[model samples]
Target: MFGGPYPWSLYCGQWSILPPAPKGNYLKDKVVVITGATSGVGLEASKQFADASPEQLIFAVRSVEAGEKLLGQIRKAHPNLQDKVMYLDLTDLQNIKDFSEAIKVFGRVDILINNAGINPNFDEGPYKSTKDGYERVFQTNVLSPFLTTLLLLPLLRKSSDPKVIFTGSDVHHIAPSDLIETALQNGQSIISAYNDEGKYHNPTRYYESKLLLQILSRNLIKTLPDITTINVNPGLAMTNLGRDFNLSLSPSGIVGILWFVANARSASKAARNLTSAAA
Candidate 1:
């Protein structure tokens, strides 16, 4: 059941028995950077890394205020956590470039975790595009992360054993291909295809984006053999991911809640996968 055309071996097996987080101060001299560290899996991964005692931990978040608040909470427990929170809005390509340049102050990045993502509810309205003229979800989940990794490659290469990690998902296996086929048939670029409001499908957008991300991660492995690139499937987790869905106490919201209850694990537990991959 775990291994087939849709191989769940690596995904399901790992979820069933998550790798143990490092126990010692192994990251003493390493500079680790994580995006979306103020919430959900990102927040928990930040905490886990903090406990491990990294030389430097940077949180690339959308809000500096929220990042700092999270840092304060972490400091309360560790009392000596060396961390900084910087603003990084994945919705804007320019903002991602600016954030990457700002990271130069840290010199080198040993671990870069592109953990931030979004799943907008298509049920609410038609597809919306970012200022960069890409679909909001596509830009946030795929393009921005790809750009961040590209910009940070030079710094990551400077490290002895630099690693780049993407928080992928299992749903990618079930993502539809008809959208892509239709895009190709119409001779539209991948970006333009996804940006097309007529072609927008809520159930498939996130899955397709993640599938694309995993594909990119694999290419990184081949092209950048020196850097250890991995796409980690964190499994379903109960986080603020659905905050955009605006799930109130309505009938649909009740169904959404039930879906989470049956399928999603706690964010803290799910975050172990991220930390393990980073370690």
Candidate 2:
């Protein structure tokens, strides 16, 4: 072991490794469905899957403009993916039903990425929405995904390797508990319970939602006993999430820093991982 024999630090790169999925070997033929695929991490995931050349690439987006814009980009870049677009408004229960029905035509949904979510009414919180009668955030971030997954079970179960991934955050791990039953009150949202702006505005509910995501993932893994469920955190990345934050970055820039130093790997990478997990 001569010290001069090797200069390890000379070319050291960030050490990141994805557990090899022996199943990842078979993605070219798999049909994948990605929710919230128009922008942010969802868009990145799509970019990655474009190369894998899956049999079909279905993008579920809230806005046609966003979906169409992403479609043009992906097509221009890959030119080989059999991509299709569908309208998906997670806040609307009917929309979920519609999207689910539309997806059944595929007959097989090997991978389901519950990545689309919204963080809003920060001044109030999800517990205060009348649309679906659910917290705006809870509906989009949690229940919508919940219902969508339930609806797709028939199709996903058809795949040899069916998996569902709920993108979670560290915040979820740090929320006050009891949120479990609160979020699942007869389909409609219950904002009346938490009225203190301080209580709801704090990261509690957001984290609670994520915490529930993990719990759901675990419960589903056991309840379904036929599918693998995983929750992943993308770490801090400079995503356009601030567009939703509504906070002024000019002051402390903590959000800006989090958005900066954390590194936002392209949306394609997120898509790729979902593809990789499915593969």
Would you list the C-alpha lDDT of every candidate in the order shown? 0.84, 0.67
Clashes of each: 0, 10
Question: How well is each residue in 1-279 modelled by candidate 2, as lDDT tens digits?
Answer: 001122232112112444432333265777888888876777777767666778888888878888888889988977877888899988799989988888888889988888887654233333456376766666777778889999999998899888888776645545566543554664534444433333455334565667667777778878998888877765433456545454545545455455345444444443445555555
> How does each model score on TM-score?
0.90, 0.78
Model 2, runs deviating above 4 Å = 1-26, 121-127, 178-199, 249-276
Error of 1 at 15 (Å): 7.0
lDDT of 1: 0.84
Off by over 4 Å in 1: 1-15, 122-124, 182-188, 246-256
Model 1 reaches what TM-score against the true structure?
0.90
Best by lDDT: 1
